[model samples]
Structures are given as structure tokens and as C-alpha cells.
Target chain A: MTIATFPPEPPPPPSWTRYLGFSTDAKVIGIQYIVTAFFFFLIGGLLAMVIRGELITPAADLVDRSVYNGIYTMHGTIMLFLFIFPVLNGLNNLLIPTMIGAPDMAFPRLNTAAFWLVPVFGTLLIASFFVPGGPATAGWWSYPPVSIQNPLGHLINGESMWILAVALSGISSIMGAVNFVTTILRMRAPGMGFFRMPVFCWTALAAQSLQLIGLPALTGGAVMLLMDLSFGTSFYRPEGGGDPVLYQHFFWFYSHPAVYVIILPVFGIFSELFPVYSRKPLFGYVYVAVASFIIVGLGLIVWVHHFFSSGVPQWMRDLFMATTMLIAVPTGVKVFAWLGTLWGGKLRLTTPMLFCIGGLVNFVFAGITGVMLATVPIDIHVSNTYFVVGHFHYVIYGAAVMGIFAAVYHWFPKFTGRMPYEGLGKLHCLLTFVGANLNFLPMHPLGLMGMPRRVSSYDPEFAFWNVIASLGAFLLGVSIIPFLLNMLSSWIRGPRATHNPWDAIGLEWLLPSPPPEDNFGEEVPTVISRPYGYGSGEPLVEHQAEIERRLQLQEAAA
Target chain B: MTSTTPLAGSAPASPEAAHGHANHNLTGFIIFLCSESVIFLAFFSGYAILRTSALDWLPPGVEGLEWRTPLVNTAVLISSSGTMVLAEQFKAREKLWLFRGFWLLTMAMGGYFLVGQAVEWSGLAFGFSSGTFGGTFYLLTGFHGLHVATGILLMAIMLVKSFIPGNYTGGEQGVQATSLFWHFVDVIWIILFLLLYVWR
Candidate 1:
């Protein structure tokens, strides 16, 4: 292998404006995604708060029915289409190149183009509100017939814009997936094999693989709906002799696996946070890595479970029920592996660690609910109830967003070259964890008591839990105050970070905090050992000192 | 690569070096094709569903659609793929002019196929607004035509790129990647031809 004898090209001038503009550099583009997605997260969170506020008294007191529909639909769509997916991709883009010691993604310009599409199309989606019929009100799935023939569809905006936005974002995400798969597969440091790669890269790769296979189906469905809405065609209009159930088949075929698309990378994040904080090797690293692939495979077929009550034949539901339950095996392996990784270890309950542990507890709760829901009878019992809502919030908000916080906090030092305020960070973690359980836990009993989801108003009998959930929603909204301040204040004038403040041994920690342009500075680092080789004294077998020595000499010569 | 081999030290290296510039592009391009195929399959699946569930495949007022044009279009597209294969073979032998010549042939044929599709589309008694049979037929072929148009654009770029001396001297990575994409477009049509034109 050739050690870079020449110095890196001088970095872009460190300025905030560079981020305001387009950059082919993955770091700049990644920060763009993180910041832009955070904006959407706030907007989506506020929409949820509005929904909760409207539900406080068990009557349609606050908003009209259609407006309520728009709020919930846009909330789900914004959070999924804008917040979770892009934020994870942003973090992955930031870390993958440096993690694997590559110069950039396989297609750097395409990466930039992908980042641009998120905001461009995201605005189109959010902009649908200002137009005639307001944004789509027929749920985030926007099932056809209603989507095809609704007043909103009859009007020139709303659901059609939503479809267009989804298609564009899907294309953007597919482009991102292509770059990620290529980068991970073909651009790893010379000695880094599939097994030797970081667990996060492995999970991110698996997630991208799922996105590759699954998202196209969603795109096709959206395009067909777009056609149905615009033209007089009947792809989904039953009156036109088009079967509306076919659209459900197409939608669930992609959206069910999309559940993994949201959480699998967080599984990677938890895997990273656990090993680092516990000062131990990740238990069953291979199993954890391979489990992600297994989940992706099972995830694709189990989609029919979402349609168990939608006139799918009994045998199909039975087969899908079997597959859905089967996914819990690989997923359970992950949870157990994390628990084992934490057992009898010298654990530091840093904010990131607290979130990971709390997220795991919530993840176990969510997984149980998931299995329960996988059973046909139980799923049929709670099909459109708040119970499914509660279950996903437990998994997604409780686990995945918690993981997002942990990652943001853990890597704040790396992203901004400053240590976030640990005290504020801990407060944010506590408020979020407590607030999430309080907010979503009541959803189960309420659903059992027959409270349907997607409603701004509820029956007066469901008042107690709805009130509690609104309080929790307020708490959850307030919880971000410290997080925002910690990040903003820390970014503006907080103390600078050491190159390896965590004393972590990943290749990313070996680079400059916030990393220099031309990551690794024109030098290609070779991996000499497995990524999680902690407690082995020298974690990275690639001699960090030797690379530093060469870099120093090159810089001096320059 | 030979130039860099001299500067390299005696270090343990895996055969992954076999993934030179050519293979890297090819691998990534193929992965893209894999995803693209899933998307096309979704549209194809939609067609299958609509066709099967239809009370009558051509419900009403959809009659007298000539199949001869699409048959010829299929032949034209299939022949273009053959020309693409020939172009690659010639490029591998460093037959730059022959490579360019055959690529032009492929692009010409692809253009002819698009024209044939447009003519067929014009002659048809249906449109995207027409019911499922007409809708899927128009949309699928329209989408495929868009891809073919993109393929022609890529072919045009390669034809122009051929003029730059020494561009392909290192390896035939760029052209091979584009040819793979063009062939994928061609392959999608063969399937589209059977589903949309034949079998009825």
C-alpha cells in the first residue's frame, strides 16, 4: 500500500457560509442534512403537539376535522420522509468516509445532489399547505381511491404535491443508497473486510441495501397514484374497475420494510455507544451485523402483515404472520447482544449511554408489543387503534430518536469540534426518556379501550390517558430546549475538543475533530484489525502514531 | 496502474486490486440497475394485477390496436443491444473508431425504436387517461421510453467522449458503465414488449 507522501490539499476556509451553499464534500453536505432535518423535526414535533393539544378534552375543540387530518398526515410524512431517514443518512455520510478512512463517498457529487433533493422536495411537501386544499389529509400512506378522487386531489395541490415530493425524495434516497453501498463495498480501507468494518457501517449498509430493494416499490406506487390523480386512469379507483387493495399491496410492500429503514441504523448507533461507554467489546458483533441482513430479508416479505384485515386471504395473513414473528428473532438477538454487552462491565452513564440503555429498555417494550401485534388476532384487535401508534413511538421515538440524540451528543464533539454541555445533555436525556414513556405508554390501554388513531378528538372515556399524553407531549417538546442550547451554545463558543476526547479507537476518532477536508489528508489508512478491538491495548492495528508521523512530515515539508 | 505499482512498497495486499476503476464503476452501476429493476418490476406487477383483475382486458372503446409497430420496435431495441455488445468488444480490442461507430449504430437504432413507439402511441385508441389496460401500457412504455431517451443521451456523451484522445487509454470504465445501463434499458424493453405488445 502506498502511504501518501504528499500533503493534503488545503481545506475550505472554515466558515458557516460554506454550509449555506452546496458542497461536494460529504462533511459539508452531511451537516446540511443534519441541520435541515432538525428544522423539519421541530416542525413535525410541533404538529404532534398540536394534535395532542386538540385531543386534550376528548372533543373536536381546537381544530376542524380536515385540518386535524392534515396535521397528523404531514407529521408522519415529515418525520419519516424528512427527519429520520435524512438525519441517519447525514450522520452516516459524516462518519462512513472517515470511519473507513476513505477520501469520500464513491460518488461525491451525486451525494451532494442527493442532499439537495431533500430540502428541495421537502419544501414542496411542506409548501402544499399554503396551496388550496392544504397538505394531504388521507394519512401518510395516502391510500388510493381517496387519494385519487378526493377534493384535495380534485383540487390541483395537496396529495398530488405530496406524491411528487415522495417520489423526488425517494429518488434522492435511492441515489444516497447507491453512493453508500458503493462506498462501503468498494471504498473500505485496503484491509477492511465486510467483517472488519465498524458495526455502524454494517448496519448503515444493510439499511441502504433495504432502501435499494424496497424504496423503488414505493416510488412505483407513488408514480401510479400520481398518474391516477392527474389522468383519468384507474390504477386504484375501484369505480374505474381498478382495485384499491392493489395500492395497499404496493404501499405496504415497501412501507413495512421501511420500519427497519428508520431503526436499523440506530441499532448500529446503539452498538457503537454500548461498546465505547462500557469499555468492552461488543458482544456477538458478527451476530449483530448479520442480524441486520436477516432483518432486511425478513422485513421485505412480512409486509403483508400490515394488510391482514384488508381482504388478503387467510393463508397469506398466516404466512405473513409467521414471517413477521420471525423478524423478532434477529431483532431479539440485537437486544440480547446489547444487554450482554452491558453486563458486568465498568459502565459510564454518560448522556449518550443513558439514552442507549433507556432506548434499549424501551426497545424491549416495543419489541414485545411488536410480537403481540404480529399475531393476527392481536393486530386485528388494534389495527387502527392508538395501540399501534404507541408501539411505533416506543420503537421509533423511544428507541430510534433516542438513538439519534445519543449519536448527536456523542458526535457533537466530532461534528462541531466542541464538547456539548454534559449537564444539559443529561437533563435532555432524562426528560426525553421519561417524557416518551409517559407520552406513548398510555396509548396501549387506550387502544384496548377503543381509542382510534389519526383523530384530533377522542371519546370522553379516553380523556385521562389523552390528558397524560398531552402533558408528556409538552414535556417532550420542552425537553429539546436544553438540547438545542447545548448544541447551539456549545457550537458557538464552547471549549474545543481534543482529537480523541473519547479515547475511542475508531478511525474517525483518530482524525481531527470535525475532520479536515480531504479526510485523512490525502493518506489512505489500511485497517489492520477488527473495528471493535477494544481492551487489546492498541485498538486500531493500523499504527496511529506512524500515520501521524508521516502526516506531520508531509505537513512540515509543505 | 503500472506507474503506481512501481511506487508501492512490499506490503500485504488482497486481490481486491482487481477492482480497478473499471470494476468500481461497473459494480456500482450494477447495484443501481438492481434497484432500477425492482422499480420496473413494481410497474410490471401493477400491470399484472390490473390485467388479471380486469373483467375484460380491453374493457370498452379500446379496439383495433395494431401490434406490428411494437414488434418492429422490439426488434430495433434488441438489435441496438447487439450493437452495444459489439461496441464493447471493439473497445476492448482498442478499436476506438469501431467502438464509436458501433455505439452510433446502437444510438441510431434506439432512436428508431423511440420513433416507432411514438408512432404506435399516436396510432393507439388509448392513452394514460384510458382505463387500466391503456394506462399501464402507456405509462410503462412511456417510462421505458424515458429511460431509452436517457440511454441515448449517455450514448451521445460517450460518442463525444470518444473524441478525447487517451480518455479510454487507462481502461474502458466509463463506456462499459454506460453500455451496461443501455443494455439494461434494452432488457427492460424486451420484457415490456412481451407484456405490452405480445401475449395479448
Candidate 2:
């Protein structure tokens, strides 16, 4: 039988403008996520400053207690939902198909639908602030009775809206998760084996799978809470004979793994960037991959650690604490591997590298604090204090936020056809680093001093540390200026970037700086060698030829 | 191109091209039906958890609503699944009129099940807002009815498309997917019926 080979099809015309409302191009969808997430990040940051400002003096009276609660609630909500998940998934949606050498996501229409849902859900969440009783004061955790009994508005609809918005966001994540999994599983180019795939792709796959299983529990918890509040259904009402602790169990089942859901992709980002800046292959490829899977596996079991003070059984507490601490082993392996990758290699010290290095430094402190929290006696003292707040800030702002910035700087060339100002970029990184530590570091001492969280003001004895923290917050606000300047300046008139400006080895860098509507031009890649296999020194064409030959030989044998 | 060649190392098949003619529509319908399965699974889990944990719950008070009527509806839904299978068989054989007839019969049976659900709902003493039991019960069954209604709508669309010339190019695949969806709906209803009426 003669196999017919057709000529390559012409590239699709740029319908970006016309199809703006309905386009499924991963690049455009990614841009939408990046821009919208940045907006929310700014809003969330402003809320943080308000919180810090209010706490600067003992009995300062900057904002009332109710207003203070709203500030912190919105801060956590915006950071988790609006900023972290969208930014990570947005980067994945934009880059994964291109990186894996596919035309688009496995389900492109569904991908588009998922992206649109973010803004809708985000708008609803933000709009709840204007409701009669105000945004949910139940904290981001929104624990029951407090969450359920709060008068949300005239119709008590704020909590309902919160549940509905969260459910909508869950739906979006589920759809995106399904698309990422299917695309990575079935739609890879001919020779892109699972092991040969990029670390970011691996992380994306793991995170999305986590989302698929994890989200349903949250949705279940949210629905039960909504029912309890709206219709007097006793899912969590103790008066009606429902146990509130059951709500905690169901909620943490998803929420605990959700911490990994936020941080794992950030790990993926570092996995990609550390090698590029260090000019070496990732030190332990298989180890890092296995570690990510272990994190996901371990993440589900350790959620009870969040409820250590709730009087759970001692054996369960010990089990959870042990699992939580054991998680640090794999996490430690990743950190050491990253440091090893950076060792003995010529470092670039670019904007991305600065953030990557900054992330490593901060992650060390965060991990140490995490280990401290793992001990039950210590956690019981600091569970709701500034200590817990400081620890998470070190993880989220220190590790995850820095990793996100690293990604933005690394991939901005691919997204925009222009390079960000490297000098300004470095400045942003430095100020953000110093300002972040200054802002969060003192909170440890404050927490140790028995200063609780979510309070508008503090006692006079703790006023000195609060002043230092507020100063850092103000400096942190200034630090973002250079980033805004760099982004706006670069977007307007920055130097045009080459397709592969950094001599990157990935398939994404092989395309145009700003890829065409359909992603590829003439060549549809079938990979043979690993993406970052730098030591072999074989030209990419030789690898391509080898892949083709293998494919053809397999065809003949069959 | 021959079927004997085996589909190995070929240019990647477009999802649409792989399910050609009769199979294309069936695959699309089945894929959608799988998505619906996830939705119902969520509802079922919620219902089961609520039922076991109900405090001081009463058996629902509804007149003329012994387990017998839902049992009969269960049989009707199960038979509709069989008819849906036969419809796909006719479709595969290119028996257009028989395909249309069975498709309509399946939709009509689905409609009858919905009517039975309405009668069941009308007889309930407690509504969705009454308590945890009522909330879970109504939400579970209500979501299932929505799926049945959607399936009926899809079948009606297929029924109309069967008569239009040049409309049924993707042969058995589309109908196969639709049948999978219909069967899924049927199976879920059976599970719900047994759990709600007979399990206790």
C-alpha cells in the first residue's frame, strides 16, 4: 500500500481581532489570564497594605473591626482564587500546547469557555463587597456557623453568592483540568515521551489531576454550607444535630491538597527556569518528577494538620503531623536539587534568575517555618497568630509569587514579541526581595509575642514590631513601581525579541516570538531527544531526523 | 486506507474525521453524556451522605406513592435503554425509518418517566427547603430530571435531523454517542430509584 503524503497546509490567517470574543488560541487566552490576574494581584496587595497599616499602632483605629475583617478576607480570597490559580493555569494554558508541539489544547472550545468563566466568577466575588452586610467576614476559610449565620445582605444573599461564585470557579478549573490532562496524555507530538517531556508539563498534569479529584470535595462542602445557610438544612448546624467538624473534614479534604495545587506549579516554573539560567540540565530529572508526584500523594493525607487544635484524636494528630513533616523530605530533595543545578554553572543573573534565586532563599525560610508548624505543641501556640501568617507569606509571597514573576519575565518574550527591560527588572526583584522579608520577618517575633491575627490594632508593647512591619509594607508598595514601569515601557517600545532570544531548547522557542494563530508554521515536530539535554551537543535536526526514521521503521514493521 | 491495513502510525486523525458518518455523531453524544455522568455522580454522593446522617428524619409522606410506581418507571427507563440500543442498531444498518421510530419511542418513554417524576414530586409533603433530607432528596432527583429533559431534547434534535437530507453524514457514531448518553441517564435513574425507594 502506498502511503499518501500531502503538502503542508497554509497557516491560518490572523483572526485574533475578529475572533477575540470566541478565540481558543492559547496565547490570547493566556494573555487574558495574565492581565486579569495581575489586576487582582494589585487589588489583593492593596488590601494587604490596608491590613498592615491598621495594625501599625496599638489601638491605632485606622479602620473599624468589621472593615478590618473585610480587608483580610478579601486579601486571602483575591490572592488564592484571583491571583495564584489563574496565573498558574493561565501560564499553562498559554504555553503547554506550544511547549508540547501541538496545535492547541485537546479541547480548545472548552479551554476558551474555562478562561471566560474566571472573569465572571471573579466579578461576582468582588461584587459581594458591595452587598448590604459586606463581603464575607468568615475569613477565607469561611468556617461554619460564623460563615453560615452572618447576615450577608437584605436577602442574606452574600454567602449564597460566595458559594455560587466558588462553585462557578470550580467548574472552570475542572474543565481546564480535564483539558490539560487530555492534551498532555493524548495530544503530544509523535516522539514526546512522558519522560522526555518538560517539568512544567509534568507539574501541570499533576496539578490538574489534583484539581479534578480535589475540587469536587470543595464543591460538596460549599453546597452543604450554602444549604445550611439558605434553607436551614443541617449539614453543619450543631443546633440541628449536624456536626461542624464534619464540615472541617470535608473542606480540608480539598483545601489541604489545594495548598499543593497552588505551590506545585510554582515548583514546575522553577524547574524550568533554574536550568536555563544555570546553563545546565536539571540535576535530577527523575527525582524531581517523582518528588512532585509524592507531594501530590502526601498532600491529600496531611490536611488534618490544619485542624490540629480542633481536638481530633491524638493518633490521628500524630499521623497527620508525621505525614506533614515527611512531605518536607521530597520538598527538601527538590530544593537541594535546584541548588545543585545552580552550583558550578555560569549564572546569567537576569531578571528571571534573580526571582528564581530569590524564591530559593525565601523557600528555605518558609520550609523551616513549616517544619516548626509541623510540631503539634508549637503549632497549638501559633495556630491563629502572626506566626502562621508569616509562614504562609514566606511560602506564597516568597516562593509562589516570586516563581510567578520569574515565569512572567522568562516567557514575556514569547507572549509579547518584546523583551522586558532587564535593568528595571533586576531593580524590581531586589526591592521586592528586601521589602518582602522586612514586611514578613518581624511577624515571627510578633507571633511569638502572642499577637493574634485578623485584628485591626495591637497592644502598645507590640507597637514597635508593627511599625517596622508597616514600614516594610509601604516599601513593598514602592517596589511594585519598577515592575509596572518595566511592563508598560516594554509593552510599548522595548527591543524586538528573536524567536529564540535565550537560545532555549524547548519547542516553544522554535516558533515565532509571538506565535501565529495556529501555533506552528511549516514544521510539525516529532521529538527524539530530551528538551534540555545540553551535554550531548547534537544538533536538533539530527534528533528530528532520528525521530522520523524511527517512526518510519515502526510503520514498516507494523 | 482499507480497514485491513490497521490504523497504526497514520497522520493523527482529527477527532471529527475519526468518527466518520454514523460513528461521528454517536461519539460526540457519548462524550457529552460522560460529562453529564460526572454531574449526576456528584448529586448521588451528596444524597447518600445526607441520607445516612439525617437526624430524626421521617419517611416521606406522599399519597399513592408506594415503591411500585417508581419500580414501574424503572422498568420503563430500562426498556427505553434497550430501545435506544435498537435505534443505534437500525442506524448502523442504515434503516432510517426504523431508526427514527425507535428514537422517538425512546424519547416518549423518557417523557413518561419525567411525567412519573412530576407525579412523584407533586405528592411530597416536604419541599427542598423543609430540611436536610428534603434538600438532598429534591436536589438529587431534580438534577436527574434536568438530565432526562436534556436527553429528550437531544433525541428530538436527532429525530428532526434524520429527516433532513445531507444531515446524517456522520453515520452510526453520532447515534452511538447519543445512545450512550441515553443509557447513562437510564442507568443513573435506576440507581437513584433503587436507593431512594428500595435500599432502606
Report chain B TM per candidate.
0.84, 0.79
Q: How does the DockQ of candidate 1 come out?
A: 0.38
The residue-by-residue lDDT of candidate 1 on A66-140, one tens digit each, is 899999999999999999989998998898988987767788778989999999998898899998878888898
| Model 1 spans > 4 angstroms off | A1-13, A150-155, A545-558, B1-23, B63-65
Worst 10 residues of 2 chain B by lDDT: B1-10
TM-score of each: 0.93, 0.87
Model 2 TM-score (2 dp): 0.87
TM-score of chain A of each: 0.96, 0.93
In model 2, the runs with Cα more than 4 Å from the true position are A1-21, A150-153, A540-558, B1-55, B59-66, B161-195
- Candidate 1, after superposition: displacement of residue A333 in Å? 1.1
